[model samples]
Target: MRYEKIKTLSELKNIIKGLRAKNKRIVFTNGCFELLHAGHASYLQKARAMGDILVVGLNSDSSVRKIKGGPRPVTKEKDRAKVLSLLWCVDFITIFSSTTPFNLLKAVRPDVLVKGGDWKVKDIVGSDLVTSYGGKVKSLPYLKGYSTTGLIKKINLLTPRRCAVRTYAAGKKGNTL
Candidate 1:
């Protein structure tokens, strides 16, 4: 069911065209979304409330690696897209291999472009293109203390190094930890 929400760029463009014919407002946002969190859900919901449809442009695995460096994006792009597709607020998703969503924005031409509060409207990539076409650009409120990096760090702190090694050795020995 969630898989249906993921679309190719051409498919998404056609879908957007149809929606626009019916006067539906399209909201757009892009991110790596390496790990889903409460903050991501809240921001997406808020962005959806601003328009009739919400299209999320997910960064491909290579793109994430380029932007965030090695060993980032703990989850692969397909997995990330699948998780986001499960969210009710996300109408459709398109995976892009670019560092920025500027080209994707040019294709979607969303009615509203949004990003987390951490990004100023002027700093959001494609903000100029969106605004030039009379589309609105918004910076939604970012939830504090909720981030993938923080979650990863917390998880690392909770997993003792010795415990991890023991768990691995036990699994290899056909034993349960």
Candidate 2:
């Protein structure tokens, strides 16, 4: 079945409500997903297995910048959303600007909220909200050493190192060298 992509909060809410009325199980997961890696694919597959529908919340460009600092999310938001929207395990993708998935959680009210094993259940975003709504929160085992940050660090290490020259300008404004 061809799934539709939801761009606005209102549309997403409507879709979720409609799905719920049809008794469709909804699962949600959120992340930056700068570079879609093996771990991401597997995690998503697992998440989809736990429910009838899977919705991915992608952090907006500004949100990525705010949390990951500049030079982050090498992929633009449009590209990221497009890529995620095409994933086999993902039924829908939504872009959000919040630092956390709190607002989106309140709106979608997914039947299942999923995260990587790295987070304690209590600390995971949307955990409380899902539980409060009588929905379940789950964690998928993280495929270690398969994250975007780790990939970036590996790239940096593989590149040639530059020496920091310690030449003293020695208060050169006053010519104290």
Model 1 C-alpha lDDT versus the unseen true structure = 0.93
| lDDT by residue (tens digit), candidate 2, 25-112 | 9999999999989999999999999999998899999999999997987999888888787888898899999999999999888899
Q: CA lDDT of each candidate?
A: 0.93, 0.86
Candidate 1: which stretches are off by over 4 Å?
160-177
**Considering every candidate listed, which one attains the maximal lDDT?**
1
Cα lDDT, model 2, residue 13: 83
Residue 141 of model 2 has an lDDT of 88
lDDT tens digits, residues 25-83, model 1? 99999999988999999999999999999999999999999998868889999999999
In model 1, residue pairs whose N, Cα or C atoms come closer than 3 Å (at least 3 residues apart or on different chains), thus clashing, are: none
Candidate 2, position 105, lDDT? 90
Q: Scored by Cα lDDT, where does model 2 land?
A: 0.86
- Alpha carbon deviation, residue 90, candidate 2 (Å): 0.2
Per-prediction CA RMSD (Å): 2.7, 9.0
